[model samples]
Target: MEAALIAFATTAATLSVTVVLALLEFRRRRREAVQARREQIVGRVLDTLERATRAASRAPIVGWWAPNELEYALLLPRLLAELPEQDNAVATWVARRIQHLQAATSRREQVAIGADVAAKVVQWGR
Candidate 1:
């Protein structure tokens, strides 16, 4: 009977450990999935922004002539919102750039802000 009890206890301990490990692995995978999704969103937004900036630079005028600001403004805020609280500097910089891009009064101002935004987006990729 003692031998049987020891075997049962060993089995129980092994099962418990297996369960704990499985749970931990599940949690880790879930976290990684969430992070991947976030990065995908950010990447897409940045790509769109980069394309917009390129288009703007090639255009004759830089004011509201660029048709991308409306879409960019909408997408950028969402990306910023998804960023972790620890990334406040990035969030703040993007927010300020978006605001400046939107409020730019002259063609020169728009061009300058667009250049800054392009440079920042490139930096973020690294």
Candidate 2:
């Protein structure tokens, strides 16, 4: 009877450890998945912004009024808000550029802001 009890206790302890390890692994994987999704969203926003910048260069005034520009302007704030505060320098830089772009009143100012944003996005890729 004592031997049986010892064996049962050993088995229970092993199972408990396994359960704990599995739970830890699950949590880790979930966090990684969330980070991956956030990165994907950030990439999309950057790509869109880059494309809009190119479009803006073609026609400084008309490009600012383009559909792509409007879409990017609408999406940037929400994406910037979603980014984690830590290790988010690129997001922060983009946010500042967006603010500058929004505050721009002249075509030359808009073009300059677009070029600056494009340069930062290129730098971030490295």
**Root mean square deviation (Cα) for candidate 2:** 4.3
lDDT of 2 at 28: 100
Off by over 4 Å in 1: 61-65, 80-93, 104-126
CA RMSD, predictions in order: 3.7, 4.3
How high is the lDDT of residue 123 in model 2? 58
Writing each residue's lDDT as its tens digit, candidate 2 over 1-126 gives: 999999999999999999999999999999988767666765776677666666656765676457555766776777667666764776777777777776778756766787777666555544
lDDT of 1 by residue, 22-126 (tens): 999999999898777656756766676666666656646653566766766677677767777777677678778878876877556766786777677556645
Q: How accurate locally, in lDDT, is each candidate?
A: 0.72, 0.71
Query: How does residue 77 of candidate 2 score in lDDT?
Result: 70
Q: All candidates' TM-scores?
A: 0.66, 0.63
lDDT of 2: 0.71
> Measured by TM-score, how close is model 2 to the native structure?
0.63
